[model samples]
Target: MIWLRKTRLILLMLRGMLICATVFPWASVAMRERLIRNWSRKLLKLCGVEVEVQGLAPGQPAPRGAMMVANHISWLDIYVIHSWHPARFVAKSEIRSWPLVGWLCEKTGTIFIERGRKRDAHRVLHHITEVMRDGDLVCVFPEGTTTDGTEVLPFHANLMQAPVAGGLPVQPVGLRYLDAATGEPTAAPAYIGDLSLLDSLDMILRSPPIKARLVVGQMLHPMSDNRRQLAGFAREVVADLARADLVAAAASVSRAHQVEAKGADQPATV
Candidate 1:
């Protein structure tokens, strides 16, 4: 069954890639956003994943020209977020060579940064500022690498300078994956350490359905000239949000088990 599902998903992804490669670049902004959203949602469904969003109210508009910083996890992070809100992402330059995936990312306006190069970081920051100035949302995983969904790594402060330079609000987003049945946090989606993309995808494909919970925390208004301070505050916000969600999920699960226990202890009627 896993292989069958995987086969179907691969076929769907291939179809999506073709559309993205040949047609996405020609579409207008509105049309492109709609297509990307629909495509991402469908891909999540095919992967047997569902998303539950919190914190941001329904019908409330996301801040214009805001800089969004999220914790990095799997490659699915991009599709998961785009499934909810469309934003141009700043990804590592290594992604630019990943065959069809790389091609689609470039066409969709992703800014690739060459890691370990101070000059490249400065160049990308300038580009990010321009994109934010244009009233388009831009996202970055300031953690610089993936982690298990349980914790958020420290954010790299250099990129936070983009929001400061553009005079844009910085929004911290928290992402966590939970087991669909037990509601406990799951590490199956973490793309960390030495795991290759194919290895991570295989793990996700073989697991049962999971829930991607996104917590949109309050926007931080940069009050100081210090970029490091801004980055620290944003990281604190994301960490707090993630911790709160884990506590709530654990409480809910405990209550569920208690109710089940109480029911089991009740005597059966004659």
Candidate 2:
């Protein structure tokens, strides 16, 4: 794999510094979130990456207090999903240190958890319960880890537990990538092995626009009571999402040049 060239690497570092400076303010969580969302979307576009969303219409109004569970494919998937919807993410704690991404995550009210740490995870869960009770939206990647665009991994039960509290409904979202009808388009998906982050960044910067499909699947209401019930329900959602129309009929999910919010942006829980 080609590492980032020295000049491009310097440019990337400067971009990171700029990202931190712009988004790391004491502004209300809402304003910070919109800034991060707008920036992330811009960055991806700068990389020549175009996004598409199916299963839902653009600017289609959605109810609040909903949980979106989608298949995890790559780090870019978050941008693809978030660009389509203004929703908070449930992320692993490690991601909290990923340079510009981490800073943006903090400012945007991303619910982070210490993986495999029961106590820390519990705190996050409690926070999620509070968010659900408040009637907001949260997007979950139950596949947990990223994967190649081939198959969906078995979702961990813990990730699915967030929607259980307050009896909120879970919405399954299917994320997939395909080649253009003519030629085989390349893609960068999550696979095993600790590949250098810079490598992924450089690779994407040099590639053509990928065709993506973010299918918002049917919404499944939670089966009341805790325990494995929520996990089971999540599993069902994952199953349906895995089977949704991937590339048969492509739909676009591109955001307009700007998304003008109705009010001042302040951070709010999912």
> Which candidate's lDDT is highest?
1
lDDT of 2 by residue, 1-270 (tens): 123343544565466456556655556656655655675676556655666666665677655777777777777777777676667789988889987668766656688888888899888878887786787678777766776766766767675566665567777777766553533435554433576776676656555566666677556655444425455445544545545553321211101001112111434445
lDDT of 2 at 45: 63
TM-score of each: 0.87, 0.74
Q: What local lDDT score does residue 261 receive in model 1, on the 0 to 100 scale? A: 50
Worst 10 residues of 1 by lDDT: 248-257
Q: After superposition, how far is residue 106 of candidate 1 from its true place, in Å?
A: 1.2
TM-score of 1: 0.87
Per-residue alpha-carbon lDDT of candidate 1 for residues 33-102, written as tens digits (9 for 90 to 100):
8888888898888777899877777798766698998888888999998998889999889899997788
Clashing pairs in 1: none
Local distance difference test, each candidate: 0.81, 0.62
